[model samples]
Target: MTAGRSRARGVATAALLGALLSTTAGCGSSPSAESAETDGPKSTWEEPASYSYTLTSSTQVLAGTFRVAVRDGKVTEAVGADEDSRRQAHDLPGEVPTIGTLLQTLDRARSEGADTAEAGYAADGRPVRISLDWDKNSIDDEALYTISSFEPTPG
Candidate 1:
Protein backbone atom coordinates (compact mmCIF):
# COMPACT_ATOMS: atom_id res chain seq x y z
CA MET A 1 0.00 0.00 0.00
CA THR A 2 2.77 2.43 0.86
CA ALA A 3 4.51 1.68 -2.43
CA GLY A 4 1.28 2.18 -4.36
CA ARG A 5 0.75 5.55 -2.70
CA SER A 6 4.29 6.58 -3.49
CA ARG A 7 3.84 5.62 -7.13
CA ALA A 8 0.64 7.64 -7.31
CA ARG A 9 2.36 10.68 -5.90
CA GLY A 10 5.19 10.29 -8.36
CA VAL A 11 2.76 10.09 -11.24
CA ALA A 12 0.98 13.22 -10.11
CA THR A 13 4.26 15.08 -9.85
CA ALA A 14 5.27 13.92 -13.30
CA ALA A 15 2.00 15.11 -14.74
CA LEU A 16 2.47 18.53 -13.24
CA LEU A 17 6.02 18.67 -14.53
CA GLY A 18 4.85 17.74 -18.01
CA ALA A 19 2.26 20.50 -17.97
CA LEU A 20 4.85 23.01 -16.87
CA LEU A 21 7.24 21.90 -19.57
CA SER A 22 4.60 22.20 -22.25
CA THR A 23 3.68 25.70 -21.14
CA THR A 24 7.28 26.82 -21.08
CA ALA A 25 7.92 25.37 -24.49
CA GLY A 26 4.95 27.29 -25.80
CA CYS A 27 6.35 30.48 -24.32
CA GLY A 28 9.75 29.81 -25.88
CA SER A 29 8.15 30.32 -29.27
CA SER A 30 6.97 33.87 -29.58
CA PRO A 31 3.21 33.97 -30.03
CA SER A 32 1.79 36.10 -32.81
CA ALA A 33 0.02 39.22 -31.57
CA GLU A 34 -3.04 38.30 -33.56
CA SER A 35 -3.17 34.85 -32.01
CA ALA A 36 -2.83 36.31 -28.55
CA GLU A 37 -5.93 38.40 -29.18
CA THR A 38 -8.53 35.75 -29.77
CA ASP A 39 -11.12 37.32 -27.48
CA GLY A 40 -12.12 40.77 -26.23
CA PRO A 41 -10.65 44.10 -27.30
CA LYS A 42 -6.94 44.70 -27.61
CA SER A 43 -7.07 46.95 -24.59
CA THR A 44 -8.67 45.51 -21.48
CA TRP A 45 -9.70 48.88 -20.11
CA GLU A 46 -11.93 49.61 -23.11
CA GLU A 47 -14.75 47.77 -21.34
CA PRO A 48 -15.71 46.79 -17.82
CA ALA A 49 -14.96 43.06 -17.53
CA SER A 50 -12.51 40.38 -16.45
CA TYR A 51 -9.22 39.32 -18.03
CA SER A 52 -6.90 36.40 -17.52
CA TYR A 53 -3.38 35.41 -18.46
CA THR A 54 -1.34 32.28 -17.99
CA LEU A 55 2.31 32.62 -17.11
CA THR A 56 4.72 29.75 -17.33
CA SER A 57 8.44 29.17 -17.05
CA SER A 58 10.78 26.18 -17.06
CA THR A 59 10.52 25.97 -13.28
CA GLN A 60 6.95 27.00 -12.58
CA VAL A 61 3.65 27.99 -14.18
CA LEU A 62 0.69 29.97 -12.87
CA ALA A 63 -2.67 31.19 -14.16
CA GLY A 64 -3.99 34.58 -13.10
CA THR A 65 -7.47 35.90 -13.86
CA PHE A 66 -8.45 39.37 -12.74
CA ARG A 67 -11.80 41.11 -12.43
CA VAL A 68 -11.49 44.88 -12.39
CA ALA A 69 -14.20 47.52 -12.09
CA VAL A 70 -13.85 51.27 -12.28
CA ARG A 71 -16.33 54.10 -11.88
CA ASP A 72 -15.87 57.85 -12.10
CA GLY A 73 -12.09 57.52 -12.11
CA LYS A 74 -12.21 55.37 -8.96
CA VAL A 75 -11.43 51.70 -8.68
CA THR A 76 -14.54 49.84 -7.69
CA GLU A 77 -13.38 46.24 -7.63
CA ALA A 78 -10.12 44.40 -8.20
CA VAL A 79 -10.11 40.64 -7.76
CA GLY A 80 -7.54 38.18 -9.08
CA ALA A 81 -7.49 34.45 -9.72
CA ASP A 82 -9.40 31.78 -7.86
CA GLU A 83 -8.86 30.90 -4.18
CA ASP A 84 -5.39 29.42 -4.59
CA SER A 85 -4.18 32.00 -7.08
CA ARG A 86 -5.70 34.71 -4.89
CA ARG A 87 -3.52 33.46 -2.05
CA GLN A 88 -0.49 33.86 -4.31
CA ALA A 89 -1.68 37.29 -5.47
CA HIS A 90 -2.28 38.33 -1.87
CA ASP A 91 1.39 37.77 -1.10
CA LEU A 92 2.34 39.93 -4.10
CA PRO A 93 1.22 43.43 -3.03
CA GLY A 94 3.01 43.19 0.31
CA GLU A 95 6.17 41.59 -1.01
CA VAL A 96 6.77 44.10 -3.79
CA PRO A 97 6.52 47.86 -3.39
CA THR A 98 3.76 49.76 -5.19
CA ILE A 99 4.56 51.42 -8.54
CA GLY A 100 3.73 54.83 -7.05
CA THR A 101 5.97 54.35 -4.03
CA LEU A 102 8.87 52.92 -6.04
CA LEU A 103 8.82 52.82 -9.82
CA GLN A 104 12.37 51.53 -9.99
CA THR A 105 11.49 48.34 -8.17
CA LEU A 106 10.80 46.71 -11.52
CA ASP A 107 14.07 47.83 -13.02
CA ARG A 108 15.96 46.91 -9.89
CA ALA A 109 14.41 43.46 -9.84
CA ARG A 110 15.32 43.07 -13.49
CA SER A 111 18.91 44.05 -12.81
CA GLU A 112 19.19 41.68 -9.90
CA GLY A 113 18.39 38.30 -11.52
CA ALA A 114 14.65 37.84 -11.17
CA ASP A 115 12.90 35.07 -13.05
CA THR A 116 9.36 36.42 -13.64
CA ALA A 117 7.68 39.83 -13.29
CA GLU A 118 4.66 41.79 -14.62
CA ALA A 119 2.95 45.24 -14.41
CA GLY A 120 -0.63 46.30 -15.17
CA TYR A 121 -3.17 49.03 -14.50
CA ALA A 122 -6.78 50.10 -15.01
CA ALA A 123 -7.74 52.75 -17.51
CA ASP A 124 -9.23 54.94 -14.82
CA GLY A 125 -6.20 55.30 -12.54
CA ARG A 126 -5.75 52.37 -10.16
CA PRO A 127 -2.79 50.16 -11.06
CA VAL A 128 -1.90 46.66 -9.89
CA ARG A 129 1.30 45.11 -11.08
CA ILE A 130 2.92 41.97 -9.65
CA SER A 131 6.52 40.99 -10.21
CA LEU A 132 8.49 37.93 -9.14
CA ASP A 133 12.25 37.89 -8.83
CA TRP A 134 13.47 34.37 -8.59
CA ASP A 135 17.04 33.91 -7.25
CA LYS A 136 17.28 37.68 -6.96
CA ASN A 137 18.59 38.09 -10.50
CA SER A 138 18.24 40.57 -13.36
CA ILE A 139 15.35 40.96 -15.81
CA ASP A 140 17.19 38.74 -18.30
CA ASP A 141 16.35 35.78 -16.12
CA GLU A 142 13.01 37.27 -15.14
CA ALA A 143 9.65 36.95 -16.90
CA LEU A 144 7.53 40.10 -17.09
CA TYR A 145 3.84 39.17 -16.87
CA THR A 146 0.86 41.46 -16.49
CA ILE A 147 -2.96 41.58 -16.67
CA SER A 148 -4.90 44.84 -16.87
CA SER A 149 -8.70 44.61 -16.60
CA PHE A 150 -11.56 47.10 -16.26
CA GLU A 151 -14.96 47.06 -14.58
CA PRO A 152 -17.05 49.54 -12.62
CA THR A 153 -18.79 48.72 -9.37
CA PRO A 154 -21.97 50.25 -8.01
CA GLY A 155 -21.80 53.53 -6.15
Candidate 2:
Protein backbone atom coordinates (compact mmCIF):
# COMPACT_ATOMS: atom_id res chain seq x y z
CA MET A 1 0.00 0.00 0.00
CA THR A 2 2.80 2.42 0.83
CA ALA A 3 4.56 1.87 -2.53
CA GLY A 4 1.32 2.26 -4.43
CA ARG A 5 0.56 5.54 -2.66
CA SER A 6 4.06 6.90 -3.45
CA ARG A 7 3.69 6.05 -7.13
CA ALA A 8 0.29 7.79 -7.25
CA ARG A 9 1.73 10.89 -5.62
CA GLY A 10 4.61 10.97 -8.09
CA VAL A 11 2.23 10.72 -11.01
CA ALA A 12 0.09 13.51 -9.55
CA THR A 13 3.15 15.76 -9.15
CA ALA A 14 4.27 15.14 -12.71
CA ALA A 15 0.81 15.89 -14.03
CA LEU A 16 0.65 19.06 -12.02
CA LEU A 17 4.03 20.20 -13.31
CA GLY A 18 2.96 19.55 -16.88
CA ALA A 19 -0.21 21.48 -16.36
CA LEU A 20 1.62 24.42 -14.85
CA LEU A 21 4.18 24.55 -17.61
CA SER A 22 1.55 24.37 -20.27
CA THR A 23 -0.44 27.13 -18.63
CA THR A 24 2.51 29.54 -18.32
CA ALA A 25 4.23 28.72 -21.60
CA GLY A 26 2.56 31.61 -23.35
CA CYS A 27 3.26 34.09 -20.60
CA GLY A 28 5.70 37.00 -21.40
CA SER A 29 5.71 35.87 -25.02
CA SER A 30 5.54 38.31 -27.89
CA PRO A 31 2.26 39.22 -29.51
CA SER A 32 0.80 36.51 -31.70
CA ALA A 33 0.45 36.73 -35.47
CA GLU A 34 -3.16 37.74 -35.08
CA SER A 35 -2.26 40.53 -32.70
CA ALA A 36 0.68 41.72 -34.81
CA GLU A 37 -1.64 42.48 -37.71
CA THR A 38 -3.08 45.94 -37.49
CA ASP A 39 -6.80 46.50 -36.90
CA GLY A 40 -7.40 46.10 -40.66
CA PRO A 41 -7.91 49.26 -42.66
CA LYS A 42 -9.47 52.44 -41.37
CA SER A 43 -13.13 52.51 -42.35
CA THR A 44 -13.43 56.22 -41.75
CA TRP A 45 -10.96 57.08 -44.47
CA GLU A 46 -12.64 58.52 -47.57
CA GLU A 47 -10.72 58.97 -50.79
CA PRO A 48 -11.07 62.37 -52.30
CA ALA A 49 -12.59 62.69 -55.76
CA SER A 50 -9.40 64.26 -57.09
CA TYR A 51 -6.16 63.54 -55.31
CA SER A 52 -2.53 62.91 -56.06
CA TYR A 53 -0.19 60.79 -53.94
CA THR A 54 3.27 59.36 -54.26
CA LEU A 55 3.06 55.61 -54.30
CA THR A 56 6.12 53.51 -53.50
CA SER A 57 5.16 49.95 -54.20
CA SER A 58 7.27 46.84 -53.65
CA THR A 59 5.50 43.93 -55.24
CA GLN A 60 6.20 41.19 -57.74
CA VAL A 61 4.76 43.07 -60.68
CA LEU A 62 4.59 46.74 -59.78
CA ALA A 63 7.75 47.65 -57.93
CA GLY A 64 8.57 51.32 -58.10
CA THR A 65 7.73 54.83 -56.96
CA PHE A 66 4.99 56.53 -58.97
CA ARG A 67 3.43 59.97 -58.82
CA VAL A 68 -0.24 59.18 -59.42
CA ALA A 69 -2.92 61.72 -60.12
CA VAL A 70 -6.57 60.80 -59.71
CA ARG A 71 -9.37 62.93 -61.02
CA ASP A 72 -13.09 62.18 -60.72
CA GLY A 73 -12.39 58.83 -59.16
CA LYS A 74 -9.98 57.78 -61.92
CA VAL A 75 -6.22 57.62 -62.30
CA THR A 76 -5.84 60.35 -64.89
CA GLU A 77 -2.07 60.41 -64.89
CA ALA A 78 0.79 58.41 -63.43
CA VAL A 79 4.36 59.71 -63.61
CA GLY A 80 7.23 57.45 -62.70
CA ALA A 81 9.73 58.75 -60.18
CA ASP A 82 12.71 56.67 -61.31
CA GLU A 83 14.13 54.86 -64.30
CA ASP A 84 12.41 51.57 -63.49
CA SER A 85 9.15 53.30 -62.69
CA ARG A 86 9.39 55.32 -65.87
CA ARG A 87 9.73 52.16 -67.89
CA GLN A 88 6.91 50.50 -65.98
CA ALA A 89 4.69 53.55 -66.34
CA HIS A 90 5.25 53.67 -70.06
CA ASP A 91 4.87 49.93 -70.51
CA LEU A 92 2.04 49.23 -68.07
CA PRO A 93 0.22 52.46 -67.40
CA GLY A 94 -3.01 50.69 -66.56
CA GLU A 95 -1.44 48.83 -63.66
CA VAL A 96 -1.16 51.99 -61.59
CA PRO A 97 -3.77 51.93 -58.83
CA THR A 98 -5.46 54.60 -56.79
CA ILE A 99 -5.59 54.99 -53.02
CA GLY A 100 -9.09 53.58 -52.99
CA THR A 101 -7.82 50.53 -54.82
CA LEU A 102 -5.09 50.00 -52.25
CA LEU A 103 -7.64 50.12 -49.46
CA GLN A 104 -9.75 47.61 -51.28
CA THR A 105 -6.73 45.35 -51.63
CA LEU A 106 -6.17 45.42 -47.88
CA ASP A 107 -9.80 44.69 -47.24
CA ARG A 108 -9.77 41.74 -49.62
CA ALA A 109 -6.63 40.32 -48.06
CA ARG A 110 -8.05 40.47 -44.55
CA SER A 111 -11.33 38.92 -45.60
CA GLU A 112 -9.49 36.12 -47.37
CA GLY A 113 -7.55 35.28 -44.19
CA ALA A 114 -4.18 36.31 -45.50
CA ASP A 115 -1.10 35.54 -43.45
CA THR A 116 -0.19 39.23 -43.13
CA ALA A 117 -2.40 42.24 -43.65
CA GLU A 118 -1.39 45.38 -41.83
CA ALA A 119 -1.94 49.07 -42.34
CA GLY A 120 -0.37 52.11 -40.72
CA TYR A 121 -2.26 55.37 -40.58
CA ALA A 122 -1.42 59.01 -40.12
CA ALA A 123 -2.85 61.41 -37.54
CA ASP A 124 -5.73 62.51 -39.75
CA GLY A 125 -6.79 58.92 -40.50
CA ARG A 126 -4.82 58.55 -43.72
CA PRO A 127 -3.06 55.36 -44.61
CA VAL A 128 0.73 55.72 -44.63
CA ARG A 129 1.63 52.12 -45.36
CA ILE A 130 -0.15 48.93 -46.30
CA SER A 131 1.56 45.55 -46.12
CA LEU A 132 0.12 42.33 -47.40
CA ASP A 133 1.26 38.72 -47.67
CA TRP A 134 -1.25 36.27 -49.00
CA ASP A 135 0.58 33.10 -48.02
CA LYS A 136 3.41 33.15 -45.52
CA ASN A 137 5.13 30.23 -47.20
CA SER A 138 4.89 31.55 -50.73
CA ILE A 139 7.47 33.64 -52.52
CA ASP A 140 6.64 36.78 -54.52
CA ASP A 141 3.26 36.91 -52.81
CA GLU A 142 3.93 39.98 -50.71
CA ALA A 143 3.04 43.56 -51.54
CA LEU A 144 4.04 46.67 -49.62
CA TYR A 145 2.76 50.13 -50.42
CA THR A 146 3.95 53.42 -48.99
CA ILE A 147 1.76 56.44 -49.62
CA SER A 148 2.97 60.00 -49.18
CA SER A 149 2.76 63.57 -50.54
CA PHE A 150 -1.00 63.35 -50.73
CA GLU A 151 -2.69 66.43 -52.14
CA PRO A 152 -6.43 66.73 -52.74
CA THR A 153 -7.09 68.65 -55.91
CA PRO A 154 -10.09 70.97 -56.30
CA GLY A 155 -12.53 69.21 -58.57
Note each model's CA RMSD in angstroms.
Answer: 10.2, 18.1
lDDT per residue (tens digit) for residues 1-155 in model 2: 37775455445544543454356455665544322324554556789999999999766667789999999778999999999799988888888999988888889999999987877676566677777778876655777787889999988
CA lDDT for candidate 1? 0.38
Q: How do the predictions measure up, each by TM-score?
A: 0.32, 0.74
- Which 10 successive residues of model 1 have the least lDDT summed? 34-43
Model 1 over residues 95-150: C-alpha lDDT tens digits? 32222322254445556545543343443433333344455422223233443332
Error of 1 at 141 (Å): 13
lDDT of 1 at 49: 35
lDDT of 2 at 114: 94
Number of backbone-clashing residue pairs for each candidate, in the order shown: 19, 0
For model 2, the superposed segments whose C-alpha errors exceed 4 Å read: 1-37
